[model samples]
Target chain A: MNKGGAFFGVGYLLGLFVALVAFWLAMSGLMKPLLLSLGAVSVAITLFLAMRLDVVDKESAPYLRWPVFIGYWFWLMGEIIKANWRVIRACLRADLDINPALVKVKTRCKSDLAKTTFANSITLTPGTVTLSVEGDKLLVHALYEQDAEPGAFDDMDRRTAAAAEGAPA
Target chain B: MEIWEAFLANFHAWRPWAGALLCVLGAVLVVIGTVGVVRFPDFYTRMHAASVTDTSGATSLLLGMGLMSPDLVTVFKLAAIWVFLFLTGPTATHAIANAAHVAGMQPVTGARARGDVGEREGD
Candidate 1:
């Protein structure tokens, strides 16, 4: 479980490049030639070490579908906002309006990346979290029992599965 | 024509206000979450409070900073930090909760967590 998906390939290499570039540009505001060259050299060295480590894989760099994942992120933010409102309202109530329960959520994602994304999304949203993931079953704890209604998570599952490489081409 | 131009300029001036509003909201959320953490009945519920701070508070704060940033590079930096936090926060929370679960700490059932255990465990 500690090991990431071990299928290093061009996709990971590309991911490494994009990530390093983003890191460099984000940190180095000035576009001086010297700074730019130094950043490139740094990025290259980091990529070389990553290659040597053999840890690059679909799981490590699941940003292959950037559009899909970013779209999901925006959508997740909207969901979080809604959930935050709900939790905030609940917080103000005289008696805590909570019904916490642990549930077994079934998932159809085929890959570890998809599963992890789904689980992390659940946790990122307020009032729901993923306790543990084993195979297709995710133990999720929800603040309100109704929050875990049987089919509540299907949309998230389908989206993350589609966002990851698990989607059918 | 001058009035129309001035009115439009005033409308465009909302960017700063929007950013400031977001920052205020983020601070308010963090404060509320801290209150929840103290008031919640158990470890699981307390986790919910912590997560509120993690997701909404952090996201709002970073977004505010990005919106208020003078340059694209600064926005990019804020975005990077937000994404990093988003990736790490929940995983860390899950780790803590999982560890507690493994240690045989069940979520307090019923109205509230028992004070007896709180006294023994130093709350």
Candidate 2:
């Protein structure tokens, strides 16, 4: 069981390395000489730190399917942008119908990483905030009463859990 | 009436002064937020102060600078900073609040919680 965690961490590490390399290369091309040097140095330092640090013990990390997780994030970003627009519009209305309340919900994920990701995602979306996480449950506060509908919260858990199904934690 | 109109026109014409005023407004908000953080009784309240300062200060200063300078890069940087703060501010506050709650620090309430959100009596 623990071996699975390490496998996932290694996978995540590789993904991070690739992204950083691409970012560094892009910066070198677009930026001035001094800026490019600084960026290169920063990237080098970051890679050094990441590689040297024993942060990912692997025994307790969560696994995620990279492609699926990327897709999940893209979808979530769209939702967040749309939600923020709605919140802004609602806030500017003459009579604000804000009904701020915190409610508890269950996380379908078995891993700590998935639970934390779910909680953070809830807070990232506009008008919905994660107030607390106790065990596998989350206490979330929504701007409107309707925003707290159980189905909406449950949907996030299901989607995130599905994304992490094959990934090792 | 004509004299008043001239005075208003003069005020508007002093663009730099207006920009300075906006900058001052932003600074004042940040100071007030810092004071609130120091004086507030709890972590949650402190976070509220931080968020208010983060938005008000950054927005005000950036607006002031952008208004003063017509340079494209400077304006872009200011806008970028504002956008970054908007994305991170509330998220940081939420993270702190969640951590404190999980650690079992109940939010201060009633007479102690100053500016506390009122709770219903029945619930």
Candidate 3:
């Protein structure tokens, strides 16, 4: 569990700082020096609190493979679009043809971060929401029975597992 | 710089149309989802309808407004709002569903249309 700390000294803090700066800039969109320095103070205070809480670790911010995750995000966006189309059509139909069902799925993701990512991805897509997580099993509710089949989430499960297979740092 | 200026002018002309289209799409989605919530038979089922409003409806509406935004700050704020909703909405939904389940509210499945089989089992 403690495998990634050796590589986590400056690189980890630098990454967090950069993400904070980007978020600050995106939020403010102001180029003035006074406001910029104030934002810097806010980021610094946040980082200090996070450090004090011992949350500057891989478990809390396992985005070391963020590049891969971004690619996965684009693919997930396509999935969301497709799912939205299906849900939208169902919503518009006079006779709602949805066959809602709850199905339990088994996952290979071992750590908390991977499990959460998988669950959030499922919920983010339309037509499916993870109701609960129990060990390796996830209780998912689906709008369509066909989508609840065991094979339906194979691609998603595979990709999620791959994305979460990052080094333990 | 002349081509760039021309491109900006064209974009300005088209932005309103695009924004209107997105807002219309969002409104339709929200109305449909509300109808579904009213029409659905059971608690778990209604949640599915609510999620439709939560995800696509909210996203499109925000994107529409972001398009009409006067500055980058507004766009970023809109994005931040969407992100906040996206992160918290499902968790809230899950929490509610979990609470209902704990309170012994069962989902309406096909076989148990008369609602007899599940009541005894969940306890």
Best by DockQ: 1
For the predicted complex of model 3, DockQ is 0.38
Write the residue-wise lDDT of candidate 1 on B95-120 in tens digits: 98777777776665433443434312
| DockQ comparisons of all candidates to the true complex | 0.48, 0.09, 0.38
Worst 10 residues of 3 chain B by lDDT: B113-122
Candidate 1 residue pairs in backbone clash: none
**How far does residue B73 in candidate 3 sit from its true spot (Å)?**
2.6
Candidate 2's C-alpha runs over 4 A off are A1-17, A30-44, A56-64, A167-169, B1-91, B99-123
Worst 10 residues of 2 chain A by lDDT: A55-64
Candidate 3 residue pairs in backbone clash: none
Chain A: TM-score in each candidate? 0.79, 0.72, 0.86
lDDT over C-alpha atoms for residue B111 of model 2: 45
Better of 2 and 3 by lDDT: 3
A1-169 per-residue lDDT for model 2 (tens digits): 2244767656757666676666565434456788777876886788678767754444233343567877887887677656655554443444534444556888888776677667767766765667877788888755555777778777778888877664432
Indicate which candidate wins on TM-score.
1
- For candidate 1, write residues A42-104 as lDDT tens digits: 999998998788767756765657787888888888989988887776665666757778889
